[model samples]
Target: MADLLHSVYVADKGLIFKVSGYSQNLHLVVDLVTREMRAASGRVDRHMFEAVREVRARSYHNVLLKPHKLSQDVRMNVLIEPYISVRDKVSLIQNITLEELQDFTDRFLDKLYLQILMQGNIAWTDAIKISENVLKNIKWEGLPEAESPVIKVHQLPLGDRKLRVMSLNPASTNSIVTNYYQGEVATVNDTATLEVLMMLMEEPVFDVLRTKEQLGYSVFNLVRYTFGVNGFTITVNTQRDKFTVSHVDRRVESFLKKFSKDMNRLSDKGLAAVKQSLIQLKHTTDYELKEEANRNWREITSCEYKFQRLLIEAEAIDKVKMSDIRKWVADHFAVGNKSRFRKLSIQVVGHLPNSADNATQGESGVQDHSLQLLHAGQPSTNIQENQEEFITSIDDFKKSLPLVNTPRVELAQC
Candidate 1:
């Protein structure tokens, strides 16, 4: 009796097929996977209904209500993979029948570019045999490597940018403000510098925004790597009852100002200490095989394939001087530096008292009435008409910008 755990997932680029269990079950798993991949049958309606409900449920999730995911969705769909819908349409899902689903699978399986990442106790010959067995039954024309799509992000035009969306959950009072400072496409050195910068600012950011100013209980910074574009985000989770989204946004700006000064005043010794701290972090041992495998998977999926990324980054971190940090700040994060500075501020406004005059009182008021204006191409109260700073329509704004193709990393770099 051969039994194995298996999963199929859709990613930004392609579908991933995974299976794990005893080595003895490898052939059995492959046979099962190939059979499933060739076609889909039975209970299609039930699966579609579940998927629709899943999407609906996700819309109301607390995490989705925050600016982190909201901003990410815009960045991915509008600025990155413009062709892909950030959210699947429930209407489309409802209309998709068993025949359509099967047809889609047939079309999908017709062309292929399979990337296998085999690990664990499996023998090399067994891995190769398993891969061969999986592919033998599936009729596919090998896709040219050049024809494979490379994920690209639209280069944001210089100046301040903003996208303000009313939270979908009207009863929720949790508003979020995220200030993202876009960096370059990034080299190994650039990646190292930004990581170090985040490490240094992480604690201070939380302290200044949440602890000192009492903006909100949750405040932190993140190094965002969308496809291959590198950037950083400073986020504050505040309630509408305590503070307005704009107030929190301003406080984040203030924190950045103070942080810039702090960075400049940072002594050479202090900078070295920060670098050393980051180096130590990179050197930290992977506690499990999964940890190591996941790290490799990230590089593989990102098309960077830098298995020695930690070691390379550690070296780069040591080389990053105070001047390099200052240059990075001026180029990306500085308020006055508008030429190369790309900043996008995304605000998710939650239910508030008098945030807008038309806002209804009580839990019933949780409706996203402003979304009507969004669909109508009318600027909401938060955005002014003809304001270049505010992104009235994500599609239009993205269309105005040029997409930059991220260069794939060669194995030589590894």
Candidate 2:
């Protein structure tokens, strides 16, 4: 345990250091994180350029070829802050000076609020001692205390907004399309319900889109909760040679339309089966010691102190009436309820010339065809006329239609 107190430093923007170990080794973990944080605050300029350059290189690769990164960019653009590209991020890091790095560390520390969570085989007294010692060693004395940074998530306007981004790497044929359905601010119950909904939707979505429809190799339904905002996203990663981004989007919408009806027609026995499966899953003690520690850390960092959130959600699942599920589906996915539900479509298209209209706008001076598609009402000149024609022809071929209401289903009375 004495040797375990070796310092670890992370040069990320939000957190300078994080230490996790078994609860029995709490003293060592606390000393390690505290020592690292203090050392980081004092040595901000040490290896700063190398650290930034390495991270920047990694980020650039992540943005170019990573499908998840593309999906995340769209989700963040619609639900929170617009995402800065890896290129932009790298450029920003390159311009930052050593003094700027030091200043950032100083300011960040001045306003830092330490959150600590101790669970499993640890006494409350020892936890308190650990906390006190960590704070004492961090040397936060005489510094102006700062509140945690307020997370202000952006609200999506009612109706649909489609954004098409061209991948910077033109050589890659893989394209990603993500549709985000924005809903109300998240509550514990709502989050739990959505989790179950995600579980229910995941397999079917994969089976239909990936297996049956052969839309893509990777297809998923993800429940996204950022700060207080909550939503679900359906994404497909496919190639332009096989299907256009617009074609993939339509297929996803088609699946949702069919899924709504299926949800309504779900028999009582079937619904109960799903619920039971989720409950059993929640009750399953499958997590290792390290996984449990990480879960606790996640809850603490997110300021969601419901350490037993899984159990709480399992209980909530039992209380979920079929009507609740139906209503939620109707509210979020049922078309024509545009006021209550907002959907954002993001397409990361590939470089096939046939599908060039949907090709992502490059950082360099490549003409962006989707610009006209997004701004359909704007007039165009001869040069712009050719671009508009290219976009409209693709739009017509794709049968770009407005979202229509899903036919209401009649469920048997419970």
Total backbone clashes of model 2?
A: 3
**Tens-place lDDT digits, model 2, residues 180-233:** 887777776777677777777989999999999999888998988766667889
- Segments in model 2 whose C-alpha atoms lie over 4 Å from true places: 1-13, 21-33, 36-48, 51-55, 81-87, 120-126, 141-147, 334-339, 353-414
TM-score, prediction 2: 0.76
How good is model 1 by TM-score?
0.86
Residue pairs in candidate 1 whose N, alpha carbon or C atoms collide under 3 angstroms:
170-366
lDDT of 1 at 145: 76
Instruction: Residues 148-217, candidate 1: write the lDDT tens digits.
Output: 8677788888767877776655456777788878877878899988988999899999887888889887
TM-score for each model:
0.86, 0.76
- Candidate 1, superposed: residue stretches over 4 Å from native: 1-4, 42-68, 145-147, 353-386, 410-414
Could you tell me how far off, in angstroms, the CA of residue 233 lies in candidate 2 after the best superposition?
1.2
